[model samples]
Target: MESRQRALVLHRLPYRETSLLLDLFTEQQGRIRLVALGARRRRSTLQGCLQVFTPLQIQWRGTGGTLQTLRQAEALSLSLPLTGRALYSALYINELLCRLLVPDVSYEALFGQYLQTLCQLAASDGQYEPILRCFEFALLQALGYGVDFQRCAATGTLVQDQVHYRYQAEYGFVTAAVASQDSFSGQQLRALAAGQLSDAATLRAAKIFSRLAFKPYLGARPLKSRELFY
Candidate 1:
């Protein structure tokens, strides 16, 4: 018997000559692999609906373990197109989710944030740097690696404007008389604390900080999609 669900296609790869193997982020199932049989044939409805970044309602069967077969899929929203840098950024987000999020885990809030981020990136006129940073922070929080930006991780003092600090992956941010060479500016840290996502400089700094913070969790394997941005 097949169960119906909503999912976003994070990644898809060709299987044999006509089918596809899809890595999907679902509302209830988290991440799962679905086989789309004969999807590559010309004029196939599944071919058009199963593209990455597209939102769809999918039906599949096979015990929710591995290699389940998709039974039916229908589009849930208008297609959002992402090009150039936005395209690469979308790919990076997908890669991050694919690598970090485990199968069968329920991350509904993070899933919603992921969808929102993709829509924002596709809009073009909006500033996406902040959206991306916010999504990254939310992802970390969902995965139980949230940082404490409201106060010093060391002395428990409220983070002040004049204090220099260094962020450690396991310990959040700590005040240091001699700050790390790569530490972000006080203004940047303040902006992050306030959840202000409009400043380009702050967004840039936050991205670097997020990369450092995610390193230990990511292990030695590099995110392949990140290379497209360089």
Candidate 2:
């Protein structure tokens, strides 16, 4: 049977001197690998459509294994004009999905969310850290690894604005008597929980909290795209 769906180009690599191997994220089928034969030819029609962050309508039929051969790819939307920092952040989004998401499962909602994240990146300047933070938190939540910033895990009490707390990697936030580098104020945590990252303090703490929560799932290998930030 043939399958056709809207897809986002995640990653692409040269194949066999002429073809291109693509990692694509589909709306209904999740991540799939497909090879576009002769895609490197000077007159290839797939050239413009097969790019990272470009929305495409892809058609293919599966072989026996995990890979497939691309029959056709059509552009569904215009290219997102992301450059500089925003481009790197967009790539980071791709890296996260490629690393953490389970293959062959339908991540329909996450697919939409991913596209929205890219749009947000394209529209913002250098101040999109909060947008990325929110997307990261949302992605973690979608994957069932989300950390609760609303309540203290140890005491089960509502987080208060005046208190200081520390985020344990395995558990949720706990009130900290002695603040450390990783310790976050209760107000900041609450603001993060509310997705309010306009303030510098909350934005910084949100990044720290998100990075800590994501560290385990992403494994020890650092994301290569993060180097583009520096």
Tens digits of per-residue lDDT for model 1, 76-146: 98667998888888999999999999887889888888888998999867466777788899999999998
**Candidate topping TM-score:** 2
> Residue 101 error for model 1, in Å?
0.6
Off by over 4 Å in 1: 185-187
lDDT of 2: 0.88
- Positional deviation of residue 18's Cα in model 2 after best superposition, in angstroms: 1.5
In candidate 2, which residue ranges exceed 4 Å CA deviation? 63-65
Which pairs of residues have clashing backbones in candidate 1?
none
lDDT for 107 (candidate 2): 84
Top candidate on lDDT is 2
CA displacement after TM-score superposition, residue 100 of candidate 1 (Å):
0.7
